[model samples]
Target: MNKLKLSGILAVIALFAMASCTQKKESNSPKNLQIDNKILAQNLAQKFIITDGHIDLPYHLKSMGFLDLKNTPTLVDGIKGDFDFPRAKKGGLDAPFMSIFIPPALQKTGGSKELADSLINMVEHITTSFPNHFGLASSPNDVIKNFKSGKISLPMGMENGSPIEGDINNVKYFFDRGIRYITLTHGKVNEICDSSYDPVRTWNGLSPFGKEVVLEMNKQGIMVDVSHISDSTFYQVMELTDVPCIASHSSVRKFTPGFERNMSDDMIKLLAKKNGVIQINFGSSFLTYKYEKRLKERDSLKRIFMKENNLTGKDSLAKAFNTKWLEENKLYADVEIVADHIDHVVKLTGIDHVGLGSDYDGVGNSLPTGLKDVSGYPNLLEELLNRGYSEEDIEKICYKNVFRVWNAVLDHAGKNN
Candidate 1:
């Protein structure tokens, strides 16, 4: 009786263990989810608002010496640029913040404000020219309406606060002109704040005037972009800002160590605490240190070759050599690398604090492979989906998080006014 009873008990325990193991394995298995991630990604892209925090459409147009977007041949069809009407439509991109970039050179010399105004005008003209295909989005509600109408929304974000000059009132002025966010500085320290790229940490953070600009931005319902600012500037802005700030197009600094342009782990955590969002940049240099090193090496070699050949930039020899160099040194981190940045943010914080801000049209030729242009968004969405992200999380990444910060800024401004 003892041997029979013991054997029966052992068999039952073994059966229970097998069932538990199977359940545990299936829970962790991506394949067991029985979902076609590709289709899910595509569907989610189409169904959601897909608001990228920054896109350099206005700057791209300005570079062409053409203020026109609809009549611009390159935008009508895909050119060497990373964003265009056709590509955005194909990618299901509904809302993209058209970056009004003011070159830092214009800061000391002045004219930044005028240039910013002109770029904003160009964006408005694009909407007027292609009314059926494009519309201006001044708020989150406008984006939703544009989405309903099957039109792409072109919201504006100024890439440099140089446009504001030293005038605190100009912050509200730009916001009135539909400039929703302002990157306080660019490659150089300005009157507003110290830049990450500049060696001179003039103010050590935000200048006295910069703090005024931040307050005005908050009062006027404009997001304070911290992508190009110094770590001190970021920290100071974080402390001073009443509303959530955004690194409109930055990657995880953990992936690219010492890259001040990317947010650090602690910065990300602090940002999440403030209910802010970090939109992942898809540039190869921003994604991984290894890729960034390769890019630097390639540039160094290219410069050496140019010098050795005595080829000036305008010469045919220089052009040919530059072409050859680009072709040979075109190193792209895959779309997975970009997805990894998104995953890193989500892991550190929650999915609520992360979103897409590809820096498209702004990254030059360093865009990650399979994410070459606006049309490449589905590739990223698919990667996130396959990595076990649900549609809800993807939607948040696409637009909800962006809207949350945007609305918060607006709401904060409303209360102050």
Candidate 2:
């Protein structure tokens, strides 16, 4: 009860209050908060097993004539493509469905099946050449096993169904070869279905044989990818498929209006209703209309310049002019635009029906600014975090959504068998 003791106790309490206030100020500082988010984003990127629905690495290599095992090391170290072993690891991409993109021309030239086989063989060769870094994944369980062993899973998806070669049995053949999904058509109408880009509408939808192909796919447990198919074809497949399907790398048409290559609002809604997922494509043209408009303007200007200078497209002068123009007028969507596509999907359908299907090497150089390669996934994760997405939401968007559809397809096939 002494005056000196009371004064001493009051001073100690004031010091404790001051220290607590200082701690609160530092923790809430903008810079400190930003740093915390960045760290959290990076940690999440590594914590979850990221699975991209589509990546065109197999065809990219075939086009470059680098399918031989001698060039296998480039897949781990080369910077020529958006996906490589090192970049995928940095981005936390555990399973990227390697697109076995068979061109439509091969359907008429009489070598579609052979070409598909060759590409599949090349993928097999890569895994054989570098067993420590890459593993062939035939199922979701395989992907998880590869991830646990610190290896990237190379699951395959055929970009065009041309490789089916008009034989219903070919569907099972591809499934046996590790082809999990088959995009019915690409750039042109084929026996199975019409393409979004082909105005001919040859069959007006799925051909008579195409219906059989769909049922065969369902029986064989292969996903039917509706990416480049015509609207009629898409509807037909949706009706025919018994199991949930996926649009492996298509964006919503809300941004690019009238671009049939992207799915419409109605299509997305129907897809979600059927328990399917539409993986968002990260290409700038797919994300926004601005990219296409700018691209057209640049091309028009380049054509005028070449005509004025009497330079052909093959001429070095024309090429130089095009490059310079593009540099000055960069036509690209940023990471935020990509997130907008994701947001639109989440709002239209719940978060369960949307996932990442960045058409990495397939999109050429038109990827969003910060997401230029496979290593930019953390940038995307950070954007989602900033938008108030919970960790559980991020996990579903990362892989669980697609895996649910995948496992459903497998289960359907098993039950039928």
Best by TM-score: 2
* lDDT per residue (tens digit) for residues 72-158 in model 1: 544555666888878888788999999999999998788999999889999888788778888999999999999999999999999
Give lDDT tens digits, candidate 2, residues 1-417. 999999999999999999999999999787886777788888998889899989988888877877664665457775588999898888899999999998888888878898889889999998998899999998899988998999999999999998888888899999999999999899999998899999998899999999999898899999989999999988888888898899999998999988999999999999998899999999999999999899899889988898899999899999898778878986999989889989999999989999999999998989999999999999999889888898999999999999999999988999987
lDDT of each: 0.88, 0.90
TM-scores, all models, native as reference: 0.86, 0.92
- List ranges where model 2 is wrong by over 4 Å: 1-26, 68-73, 304-330
For residue 241, what is the lDDT in candidate 2?
Answer: 85
Clash pairs, model 1 backbone: none
In candidate 2, the residue pairs with backbone N, CA or C atoms under 3 Å apart (3 or more residues apart, or in different chains) clash, namely none
Q: What's the true lDDT of residue 96 in model 2?
A: 94
